[model samples]
Target chain A: MTNLPLSVPVAPNRLSLSKFARRSPSAAIGAALVVLILLVALFAPWIAPYDPIAQDIANRLMPPSAAHWFGTDSFGRDLLSRLIYGTRPTLMLLAIVILLTTPVGIAIGIVAGFYGGMVERILMRITDIAMAFPKLVLALAFVAVLGAGLVNGALALALTAWPAYARQTRSETVSLRKSDYLAAAEMMGITGPRLLFGHVLPLVLPGAIVRMALDLGGIILIAAGLGFLGLGVRPPTPEWGAMVADGTQVIFDQWWVAATPGAAILLTSFAFNLLSDGLRDLMDPRNG
Target chain B: MSLVDISDLNVTFRDQDVGRHILRGITVAIEEGETFGLLGPSGCGKSTLLRVIAGLNRDWHGSMSLLGEAVAPRRRFTGKLRRQVQMVFQDPYASLHPRHRIGRALREPLVVNGLDNPDKRVTEALAEVGFGPDVASRYPHQLSGGQRQRIAIARALLLRPKLLLLDEPTSALDMSVQAEILNLLVTLKARFGMSFVLVSHDPDVIGHMCDRAARMAEGRIAATFDRPALAAGAAAAR
Candidate 1:
């Protein structure tokens, strides 16, 4: 009876908003705020008060003054504007990596699950081999190979992150392939890549979304980690991670200098993590 | 020409560690607009028989054809051939991909078949299945079992298929829902002149919807009864 995919459904009285509210008020608020922040980041050029990169030594370390709000960094750049502009590249990389890896991973997983044969073994083995290496270690290797830049960093993130998406997708797909609809699609001559992409891909997207939830935080952390290590969006660049990295040099006297960008990164990533959890509950098909 | 022809059909499976024979030899056929029931108890290879004919199960040795053309196990029916054949799965839940909205599921066959005006076909399919325009936008998980089964039916209809292979289409549904679906199938056939080859464990359901019912055991048909004669019990239920 449980294998019956369509048996249980959302009770007519249950609204999606109510279920979302039941899940987490903090997540809803945080998700909204984060989305707005991203929107602001996406339009930073018009929204930001000053160019994030322009240096003003006189304004440097101004300590939260209104003219150079959030205060100027030691390098005389606006921390708030830099942080605002910083959100875009990190979010962009996070989105780009997930976009690159998620579909490919999902495709591989669905095919392996749907057509459990040599293809499954090969794909799993390949994913396993890739996964065996520590993701960060692989990212480091890729960063080294691609030579420290934004798109390259995103590519590095994609290479390692894809394996997890593949593994998760494969297991989910294997279970789903046993479902009658998948077989029905095949029975209708909708087998091979068509069934994998058309049918199973949609099913796995939720799982991919869940993974992206988890990955978003990790990607930000990784980008920040790389930026902190001086491999991210190049120095004097308005990267939040790199900003925090630069701030730590003056942490004892200027606690706000280091703490502000760090807190921003922490809060934005935390919001995505919580939102992922809320989405997991809300998106459960049985819940609907 | 006969709409379906199967000869020397055999399906085998491995017991995880050891390969085992799941289906012996099953052979059956149906002409255009005819309803053929494959009735059997659970684990009697009835589903395997249907899958073989539907081109889903490859671990088989059989010759199956549609409309006088020979079918290659690997050569899936494409274009017109694909549109000519369709299937409704056993479990209403598992048969419809959960992530797909009702519209995508309904429009899938149309898209795969390269049909023009998929939107119109999707709307028509929903309406034909007793669903409204709103149902199309909702995901599979959003619909009730009866409602989901209706969508599955709507999906099958969107292809404008000449033949349909149904595997216990209503076994997972409540009796009331089953009756409603059965009635829908009956009327659709009458309206479209589509042939059916249905596999079911429920003899009563088979008798109610199919024009002919063949009992299968051990992967082979044991007895067959014409649809009109079995009305003694099924008629009262109907």
Candidate 2:
């Protein structure tokens, strides 16, 4: 009876109906809100009527008029337009930083994990040391050494960000290395590269993606903080942090000048954080 | 001729927390068309010995050969011979990746060994293990324990391995399901002319499935039974 045949149905999505349903109306609404924000950002040029940089010194601090919605800044720039325009470049920066860090971090983590012994010990120790310092402080040090610019800040953020993913993914890989199919794959004449990419990579990707989504919110915060400290976009640029910092001097007199761009930063990142929370709920096994 | 030859195999595990011996210089063999059982109690290093024969555990000190090619510990494996040897794990839930569909799980092995018709092979393999064509579209979690074990067996058989290492294939299932799978393995073996190295502590499995049985006391083989008389001793075990 060497070649007996059997029939079975494979379960779908590795989750039950109750688990999938955990992505409630509230989560979808959160996602929709995020999509709306991104859409507004994507069409900022078409949507906002006034020029973000076109300063009307005479109309400055006019306090939310019909024509000048969100009031005029100390520089007489339209706060609404600056915020809308400000989103484009920062979003672009976040996307690029994520793209670069994810692969680098995952690769390094996988290598250190799959090939244990001295190599694992050394790489993990370095990652631990890097992780001990705060992420913002590390980015700050790198940006200081690398010099201030939007790209430099993005690069610095990526440098610090890769280690977070590297450490998390390294732990994930360590657990995955012992999985039986991986061992079976190895015994079936599968090369290290083939086993690593085909088997181990696919297994860890969902977790990495979930982590990346969470990191997206963090990236926004870091970039804005850098901009606030003047290590982000140079003075007078339409960055949210730069605008907020520039408006701080006149904040005591005109509160919206400081608070408006600050509000924009809060709301945009809040949407992402909520989305991350939703994803964590969905992907986690315990929630279902 | 022996499909697999293992001699004086000793595997060890050392971590920061604990260091212990796993396989204490165990040896076993499987001839073509034979079902040999490494019948033992729990935590007896049956799986570890199978891993040594499969060339997955490089930390072991051993001499092993699959189809006449020698395996050196802590070195590169010979692809052709390695492909001729495969293993089936005890737990299907832990063995199969949650994300992959049945087809992907089956296709991966064939692809890794440089075969193109992985889907066709997957279908054929699934059929060989009693799964119908439609089962290929599903994932692991949807299947029962017996069904998952069949899939695991199908995956091992896809390569048409000479010596199949079945590490407690049916222990995780109920009695009825275990019988179904054992019948499947027996049917598959006679049909395909393949050999087996079945590791289990179950008396019925050792009695019904294997041509020869070895009781592994600690890690060394204490006795080998050529017929069903030891089947009496095996029955007394439960």
* Candidate 1 structure lDDT: 0.78
- Per-residue alpha-carbon lDDT of candidate 1 for residues A180-249, written as tens digits (9 for 90 to 100): 7776776555666787777778778787887778778878888888788777888666787788888998
Q: Ignoring the other chain, what TM-score does chain B have in each prediction? A: 0.91, 0.91
Q: Give the C-alpha miss distance for residue B53 in model 1, angstroms.
A: 2.0
lDDT of 1 by residue, B91-202 (tens): 8878887677777777766676678998988877777877667667777766777887878887877777788888888888998888888888888887888999988777
So what's the TM-score on candidate 1?
0.81
Report lDDT (Cα) of residue A183, candidate 2: 77
Distance from true location, Cα of B193 in model 1, Å? 3.7
Candidate maximizing TM-score: 2
Of the true interface contacts, the fraction found in model 2 is 0.71
How well does each candidate reproduce the native contacts, as fnat? Answer: 0.57, 0.71
DockQ of each: 0.32, 0.57
Which pairs of residues clash in candidate 1, taking residues 3 or more apart in a chain or in different chains? A4-B93, A5-B93, A5-B94, A6-B93, A10-A288, A181-B95
lDDT of each: 0.78, 0.78
Encode model 2's per-residue lDDT on A34-110: one tens digit a residue: 88878988999998878988889998876888887888887788988888888976887888898889998888789
Alpha carbon lDDT of residue B127, candidate 2? 73
Model 2 sits at an interface RMSD, in angstroms, of 3.5
